[model samples]
Target: MDKRLLDILCCPVTKSPVRLLAENELLALNRAIAADQVLNGAGARVTGAFSGGLITRDARTIYRVEDDIPVMLADEAVATSQLTDFPRS
Candidate 1:
């Protein structure tokens, strides 16, 4: 992600600052996805793992970056609370 874009992007719901997910954090999220345990705010299953992502500062939600494009849709945000073992920053 571009520094300028990351600086400007914020969580659509919380309006909180967003930061790139750390390697460990991304791994944990992917593990949860593989278990079929990750879900979007809209209650839809997150069937695919993110190659990259931005997470809200509060760690409440995450927006996936696919092919270098950020999926900023509110409904597409994955709730961290749904993960069995949520990663800490």
Candidate 2:
């Protein structure tokens, strides 16, 4: 995604700032978001912010990538296998 485009994109539901991910850390599962580990519920993750492609720390949503176009529509988004609580080990 382009830096100019990322600046304009926002969460379709929250209309809040959206950032990109590097290292494929922000996984897109079935067009939704997922992550192996996220630290918190409220904080945001940008990776490189402008350089990386769009992703979020919530791990429940993804800015859909379509034909080199980002469909940042909230309605088009879905959730991955939810892991609300992590085991204390």
Candidate 3:
């Protein structure tokens, strides 16, 4: 992800700034995904592994990045609260 683009991108719902998910955060998310414990805002099971993600500044939601494109749709957002042992810092 480009720093410039990231700097300009914000969560569509909260209007809060977003940043790239850290390695630990990504790991935790993927782990949950692999275990079939992840779901999107629309209440659909999130399948497969994500290459990367953009997390809201408040750390409440995560938007997946597929093929280097940010899927910034609200329904596609994943609530960070669902992941067990998710990173805090």
Candidate 4:
């Protein structure tokens, strides 16, 4: 992700600053996704693996990044609280 773009990106709903998802966190999320255990805020199952993602500073929400573009829509957001064992750091 570009530094300038990331610096200005924020969660659409909470308006919280966003940052790149960490390696460990991404791995964990992918694992859950593989198991068909992940869903978006809209209650739709997230079937595809994210190539990259951005998470809110508070770690409450996650937005998938596809082809270097962040899917910042509220309905597309994933709530970290739903993950069975999400890493906070």
Q: Best lDDT goes to which candidate?
A: 3
Q: Count the backbone clashes (under 3 Å) in each candidate.
A: 0, 1, 0, 0
Per-residue lDDT over 1-89 for candidate 2, one digit per residue giving the tens place of the 0 to 100 score: 67888787777676667666544433323222234332223343222221224454555554546556776655444332342442111
List model 3 lDDT by residue over 1-89, tens digit each: 88999999999999999999999999999999999999999999999888899999899999999888999999999999999789986
Model 1 agreement with the true structure over 20-69: per-residue lDDT tens digits = 98888899999999998888878899899899999998998889999878
Comparing 2 with 3 on TM-score, the higher-scoring candidate is: 3
The lDDT for every candidate, in the order shown, is 0.89, 0.46, 0.94, 0.91
As for lDDT, the candidate ahead, 2 or 4, is: 4
Worst 10 residues of 2 by lDDT: 44-53
Give the Cα error of residue 28 in candidate 3, in Å: 0.2
TM-score list, all predictions = 0.94, 0.49, 0.96, 0.96
Residue-wise C-alpha lDDT for candidate 4, range 1-89, written one tens digit per residue: 89999999999898999999998888888888999999998999999988889999999899999999999999999899988888866
Judged by lDDT against the true structure, how good is candidate 3?
A: 0.94
Model 2 ranges off by over 4 Å: 26-53, 57-60, 80-89
> Where does candidate 4 stray beyond 4 Å?
none
lDDT of 3 at 3: 90
Off by over 4 Å in 1: none
Q: How does residue 25 of candidate 3 score in lDDT? A: 94
Error of 1 at 29 (Å): 0.6
Q: What does candidate 3 score on TM?
A: 0.96
For candidate 4, the 10 contiguous residues with the lowest summed lDDT are 80-89
